[model samples]
Target chain A: MQTYSLKCYKCNVTQNDNSISRIFCEKGCNELLICEDISPMKQDPLQSMRDDEESFSLGEGSTPLIPLNKIGKRLGLEKLFAKLEFMSPTGSFKDRGSSLVINIARKERVAEFVEDSSGNAGASLSAYAGATDIKAHIFVPDSAGKGKLDQISIFGAKLHKIEGPRENSTIAAKDFSKKNNIPYLSHNLSPYFSEGMKSFAYEIYSEFGEVDHIIFPTGNGSLLLGTWRGFIDISENSNLSLPKLHAAQSSIIEPIVAEFSQKKWNFDPSSKTIASGISVSNPPRLIEIVDAIKNSNGSATSSSDNEALIWHEILAKEEGIYSEKTCAFSFATLEKLVKSGIIKKNEKIIIPITGSGLKETT
Target chain B: MQTYSLKCYKCNVTQNDNSISRIFCEKGCNELLICEDISPMKQDPLQSMRDDEESFSLGEGSTPLIPLNKIGKRLGLEKLFAKLEFMSPTGSFKDRGSSLVINIARKERVAEFVEDSSGNAGASLSAYAGATDIKAHIFVPDSAGKGKLDQISIFGAKLHKIEGPRENSTIAAKDFSKKNNIPYLSHNLSPYFSEGMKSFAYEIYSEFGEVDHIIFPTGNGSLLLGTWRGFIDISENSNLSLPKLHAAQSSIIEPIVAEFSQKKWNFDPSSKTIASGISVSNPPRLIEIVDAIKNSNGSATSSSDNEALIWHEILAKEEGIYSEKTCAFSFATLEKLVKSGIIKKNEKIIIPITGSGLKETT
Candidate 1:
């Protein structure tokens, strides 16, 4: 196996040891660590990261990339594609990350772990944990939809319905992990989990070769960061240039968009958006996400709940893609990008339809 | 395109016409028609059937087949596989047929079509219809889950919720089609729709090469007949023998099972099964379904509601496959097949996880 090192996202301080437990920099920078390769790049980047036996999969990744003709015509774009990330084993793209993180936990002989999610990630981790015969304690916001909660419990995970805001669930999971001396497998902070998302970019490259732009429905922006890393890895071997990676978020909870666009925005507890998956008040890897957008020369945008809901229905009616309201944010922002002349009408674009509408209770 | 003919399932009378309208036998035999290839079979059977431009798709078929290790161990089987058919665009295996059926309808220049389904097929047709911009009238049982109803309506299809028995929906759909002069695109009766399921068998052969047994949660048995036909087509080219194709049904509504097993069974209006997807009392192609089972050297079995529910939970917990209650019927019957010594412990087995559990309202 090739050796890897944990490099701080902000300071670039490298740690020789590549441990799953070491999520943050030891230099007190309080930034998430990224897996940096020490050995020469292999033909297959995933194989270089981990062996097939050490990896577990519920057949995540390799989702179908389809043309969005109706939606594309509606938006007056010549080329538009949607990666059906919702058709994954767990009905969400989070399976890509969960499979990798849980596989590592299993390899380390960890019998139990804790995680906190609004919905998709919890259900994803719970499913992966169940598949690997590991006990998982999924801390979810009590306000989380019944569909997701049921999905989590159905996979035999121990459900911890934490009361209060989404952040409270995160805090509860951390406290429980610390008290119980178990690892907190936060999908947001885990380097291994993020590394798994690199497959999305690879798959995009494999299918479309290279597109002009790629948009994401961002919350913690793990997928966005991983996609950037994947493109970077591909660039090392091929002359393919990086696709402009855009992050689409709900306007009511637009931390990344607010910072990137230099617009005044704040979290309002009283406010709510139908796109709950991206309703992150404060993302931990905010700097990393911004850095990726800056590096790709991409833009971050936000849309109203109504616009997202409208596009959600449009996607179903026009493109036959019944995706969650969160996924609609990309199309909602795509329209704005096109109107503003940032994305040319003829330019090729791809959007990852992050989760299925079936996961929505409403 | 190569010329095709429609052969009666019962009388075996061949009609050279392959029109989408000719669903029933022209000789007034009241039997369903099956598409028979007139041209020499090509390397790709699907290509031989329809041209790329003529076919519409929502990225259906080519689902991942994964090993069910924990369930295999519990069932005392050496090898067990599940084709994750639920991961299709519409969250059901029905997408395979809908794509072909709707594509044919589009080519026929049909303005509107009517279909009756318990849930999955209706949603599948609605999605494909939406993509093609064709008007679809989906008549569903009023007792159908809210999730499925919402799915149909979300795709901009007109939904007709019929009251009383499941048969009422079928009656209403046929009546509406006749009254409005719209074509009845009955998924169960459509030769093209059933023919589309051949891809399922082709995928299995491509992925695993061959397996001992393939089980299905049967309702109308379109997938079963299609798979059998596909295997036959493959056998013509390769030396691969047929896999015993079994049909698993709900004991409460077991027309295929009753006929195949030579047991006394009747549909009871008072009785109920949680496996609603396979709750068809009278399947249109009943004789054909039975013939395929017998020809494949396979048996049909039924399971009680409680048994199916238990296995459904087991599948989610053990294999991390969150499938609908209908899928549990296959596993329930598999246990019986193993206990009766019909299936050996070392033999390879496969079950198609037909639909996603996320579609369930309860």
Candidate 2:
């Protein structure tokens, strides 16, 4: 069996694998836990995962990389492609993270858990937990979309409707987890979930060698970070250079965008946007996300609600890909990148469509 | 190049492959056209598909066959599997058919079309039609769920909302198609559409060898007919026997079930169920659906709305598969088949989960 240590994202604090289960830095530094493999042996993580009896799989990974030939030509690009992550079991990319998190939980023989999400992650976690017979308490804000909340409850997760803000759900979930001694399987912090997203990057590399750029809809930066880490791992084993990784966010609540743009962002309670998935005002992995963007020489951009919605409709009408409102940020940003002479007219680009359009309403 | 003919489902009449596109039998017999290979050659369809530069793709087929281990044990079974067809790009099994139908349209150089669906097929066809830059007019009943209608429109299909009955939408679509000289790509009757579903059966056989039983959610019987014909084509080359193909339906609208049970079904416009996908009072493929059921020595069963809802919840809560109320028919029928000694407890069963639960609000 492989062994790993929980390393704090903000600091140098690390804990051994056998230590008590935790979601954040044990040194009281408010940050996400990054799983660092401590086993001093030469082994392939991907091979090990493949060899394991697929733990309650809904065919999570190895999604198709569809070339947007029509959209590409329209946008003055030769190789525009879409990584169809929205076609997962839970109708979102969170399925990848949920699969790995659930596997970790199953390995630990954990029977109960508490987690918080706006929607996608909670539904994904609930599905995996139900498939494995693990009782889960999913905390969601009262303002979360009705479709997402219904999906969470449908998976039989105990729906904890936390009042007010999304942060309240996280706070309530942590308290419940502490009281019940259940592992807080946070998709954002748990390195396993982010590690699961590594599969996405590897899939792109295998299908298309060295795509110039990958545009992601960054909410809590799980996909963005996972993809960057996956590329790093792949690059270590091969001569392939890491693709420029860009993060797109809503202009209304642009934490990652603000940081990347070198501007200060204050959390405004009244701030809102149609792109509900990426409206996270205070992402815990801000440092890692910003570092990845800077290291890869990638730029971060934010789109207005009108711009996002317009792209969302265009993606459906012109491209035949009906992604969620949040997904529009990728296209909107791509347009800006092309116009600003950042992304070349002929360079290849990949965009991860975050979730299903069915999950959203007119 | 491979060649085929559009053969009538009920009679021996066949039309040339290069002839004008048609949906029904040429003799006005009110039967669907079934594509039949006429070329004296040995060519694998899969290979041909790969070489064809797939016209438009959202990565429709090859969904996961998840084993319901825990739920199987609970039900006193050793092998129970689910073909998670809801993982498709449009969040339904109809994508498989849509991909094929749209591909055919692309090859024929069709510019625009009209189609009518209950919901899932409309959304799927709209996506494909949009992806290929083919303008489409979608017709749906006014009573169709708001979420499904929203999804259909989001895909950039010009939706023609018909008032009163579902049949009116079909009539309106046909009238418009004829007036505009555009093809009416009926998901229910088109030969290309049903032929596309053949992939589902082929995938099942390749994965499981020869399963004991395959249960389908029968409305227009597209999936049921496709799977049966696929086995027929495969069995011609090998010695694989066709598995028992069962039909499951809602009690509210049991046209196919009634025919299979050798009973007359009365039209019930007022009598309704929540399973909107299979609420077809009169399926055009009624004769074909019955023929397949009787030929396979399979039984037909219907579940009450309460029974469908109970199993739907159980499937989500227990099996970690959150399908629509329509999908519950398979589980409800399975229970009956088990108790009646038709389906042995030791044998394997495969159920196709049709649509997403997110489409339906609690």
Which candidate has the highest DockQ of all? Answer: 1
Please provide, for model 2 over B55-155, each residue's C-alpha lDDT reduced to its tens digit, 9 standing for 90 to 100.
Answer: 55677788888788876786788889999889888889998888877877888888888899878999999999888888989999998888888888887
TM-score of chain B of each: 0.95, 0.95
Pairs in steric clash, model 1: none
Task: Write candidate 1's Cα lDDT for B61-135 as tens digits.
Answer: 878888898899998898899999999999999988887777777877887889988888999999989889899
Clashing pairs in 2: none
Interface CA RMSD of each prediction in angstroms? 1.1, 1.4
User: Residue B180 of model 2: what lDDT?
Assistant: 88
Candidate 1, A129: how far from true, in Å?
0.5
What is the DockQ score of candidate 2, to 2 decimals? Answer: 0.72
Identify the leading candidate in terms of TM-score.
Answer: 1
DockQ of each: 0.77, 0.72
**Stretches of candidate 2 exceeding 4 Å from the true structure:** A1-3, A10-14, A18-20, A26-31, A37-50, B17-20, B27-30, B38-47
Query: lDDT (0-100) at residue B273 of candidate 2?
Result: 85
